[model samples]
Target: MTGSTGDFAGRRIVITGGARGLGAAFVTALAEAGARVCFGDVLHDAGAALAQQLAVQGHDVGYLPLDLARPESVSAFVEAASQRMGGIDGLVNNAAITNSGGRLAGELPVQTWDAVLDVNVRGTWLMCVAAQRWLRESGRGAIVNIASDTALWGAPRLLAYVASKGAVIAMTHSLAREFGAEDITVNAIAPGLTEVEATAYVPGDRHAYYLEGRALRRPQTPADVTGPVLFLLSGAARFVTGQLLPVNGGFVMN
Candidate 1:
């Protein structure tokens, strides 16, 4: 699905790590569906370029600088995005780091672990907190946390990233319960080894493992994950919350 079904027409969405990859896909799809979106990332030039590119195409998209490792940046980004979009109705927590990848748990440095959690776990939480007020005001808010299948399958040498995502899944549950009174839905999606710039560092063997293990038997793309995200943000999933969806071609069914 291209997310151009108009399900999000007139909606205001804020996305994180949206300069490229899955985040960029989300921005593009949502804009195509008539959503006014504002996205953030630490890649300043890229973020600006993406927004400009979308603007040239007549889409209402804005880009801002954000570093999830910094709490101040998280708050500022959310507030700025809300102001620009008039308000926030949906949030996509897609920014994350894998600083501990390829290192054994015993060999993983404490600093590396801390960095991953700071960006992936604490960053996700901060974004939620920053957007909570705006989302509540929307009266029909939705949150989609980008998790990873590596966490569900226990991928070795990825302890920090996996652990952080597991925490995101748990946070989704708690946030759902806490936001339910305001009609905000919180959920997480676990995508398997999608093809993206971030995954370029992954080993060939690891890629092969995911390909061979998947029922679809093909490399996953950012588009594969975007539709599920859009659905979660749409009115269609108003009653669906506190859940984890694995969009890995059945590689790790839940």
Candidate 2:
């Protein structure tokens, strides 16, 4: 999926947590595909740098500060992005946290659990609500929620993160049904433990588990997941919604 494809030419898109890792990859891919993109992240500097870098490459991409934990921030980001792009045609809910990991479920603090849910579940919901109107108005809107394979595999010591992703998957189903009337498609991609900065905190054993368990032996990279995302947001998937596509090298076959 290079810039030459231009499948998303003239499209207006928004992405969350795009300062680095998978979000950054998504931003680059989408922009190269000729989409006018607006991406946000709590990492203000990184977000700004990424936007500038892409801009230098002749891509129409903007960066805004967004903390999904704050409803006001979510609302403001959406409004600003919409105003900047004239409207939104696609949304990628890619921001999430896994602070609850590396601890026993019973040892998880209430604050930690609450924080995870606030950003992962509640944040995702707010993004959808805020972008609803613009997406509908586009008449070709698509949403791609970033979920995790851990939710489906029941990864131990990551209860809160797992639960939050499960909610995202469930939300995809309901959102698809409701947005269907508006000609919007909502779907999810549950990626495996890919090699990204966000997952650097994960234990080596967990990484090994994923590598050893996959039908494909090679370690997963950000590029491995971007193609499916592009397809879902493209015209080819106009009729495909309420679906969960796992890009984990067949680690957990559905």
Candidate 3:
């Protein structure tokens, strides 16, 4: 699919946490693929700069401020994205946050747990709810939720983040059934420990373990995670739903 960049021409999509890292990669790749894109994130300046940069390059792209921890903000983001793109055909649930590294479940405070679950889990469902009608209007709507392989392999030293992603996988199945009759497909993309700014806190040894254990024996990049997301958002994945696709270079293969 990388051979042609306009496969998604005319498609309108909304993505969460598109200010940087993997989210930024999705935003960039989708826009270059000819999709009308609107992405929301709490990082106002970064999001705006990315949008402006893309727009200057002649891509139909826009950005808005969003705090996924708040219900009102999630609803506003969906609404704003719909208005920007004229309509919505897809939604990417990518916004998430994690506390400092190497904290056990018991060591973590309740507030940390609440914050992660609030944005990673609850925010995802709220986005789907708010985008329901707009997706239905598109005839065939697709939703791609960004999950983590940590949940699949029971990665150690991560409590709240793992639990939240596990919930995302389950929600995908349930939402797929709920949105099926409306011609909406729900799916999740589970990526391994990727090399993003957010992952910089990870220990050097832990990162080495990831590279050594994976079949590819190399690091995973945001670019590597973008193609599968694009496919899941495209017509090619119309028959695919309620499934978790891992993009971790053969790490944690099932």
Candidate 4:
């Protein structure tokens, strides 16, 4: 869509994990579309560099250090973003952790599950809660949680990651219902085996398998998912809520 047609002009957006990967792509895209972007991430160097680059390019982009696993850190990050951006017009819960234990659900250790859930599920919940309060007061907001295709189609070895993303999907629906009354839209995007540094650990065979069934016959990239995300957060999707839009290159039909 043209910049004038895009709904993000003069809007304020907050993105977690915005230092790199898909989060970085989102920040760049949103800023280019005229959204004032504030992002929080633990990668201090990368975050600072990206923020500086965007600023040099004449984009309203800010970066803050955040640790999603800590409630205090989450609160501080949200508060600072809200204060700096003059309240949030959109929130993207994109920060997550993937456990590399590679165990079956029954064989997974308690600590492994806790570690993944702490950052992926609990962190997302906290961010949403904090943003909801501000959105309620502002009377208009949009949230787009980053889910995974594995949440819909189970992954054998990544049990913890799958479970965490599944919970995110469920939470999106529940929050959408609760926040709808306050004029806030809540939804999720489930990407399938997107090309990112995090996916470097993915088995080559599994990557090939994911690509084999796609009609496009190619691995997905960060740019592949950004369009759908921009749509969901825009005025074009005002009536769309409580939905999970999968940007997985048709890897899984559902």
| RMSD values, in order shown | 2.2, 2.2, 2.1, 1.9
Point out where model 2 deviates above 4 Å: 1-6
- For each candidate, what is the lDDT? 0.92, 0.95, 0.91, 0.91
Ranking by lDDT: 2, 1, 3, 4
lDDT of 3 by residue, 1-254 (tens): 22232468888999999999999999999999889999999999999999999999999999989998999998888888898778999999999997724998779889999999999999999999999999999986999999999999988889999999999999999999999999999999999999999899999999998999899988999999999999889887888899999999998887
TM-score against native, each model? 0.97, 0.98, 0.97, 0.96
Sort all candidates by TM-score, best to worst.
Answer: 2, 1, 3, 4
Which 10 consecutive residues of model 3 have the lowest summed lDDT?
Answer: 1-10
The candidate maximizing lDDT is 2
lDDT of 2 at 100: 93
> How would you encode candidate 4's per-residue C-alpha lDDT over 1-254 as one tens digit per residue?
23232878888899999999999999999999999999999999999999999999999999999999899999999999999988998999999989744677788889988989999999999999988878777655889999999988888889899989999999999999999999999999999999998888888988999999787899899999889898888887878899998888888886
lDDT per residue (tens digit) for residues 135-157 in model 2: 99998899999999999999999
How well is each residue in 177-242 modelled by candidate 1, as lDDT tens digits?
Answer: 999988899999999999999999999999999999999999999999988999899887888999
In candidate 2, list every pair of residues with a backbone clash.
none
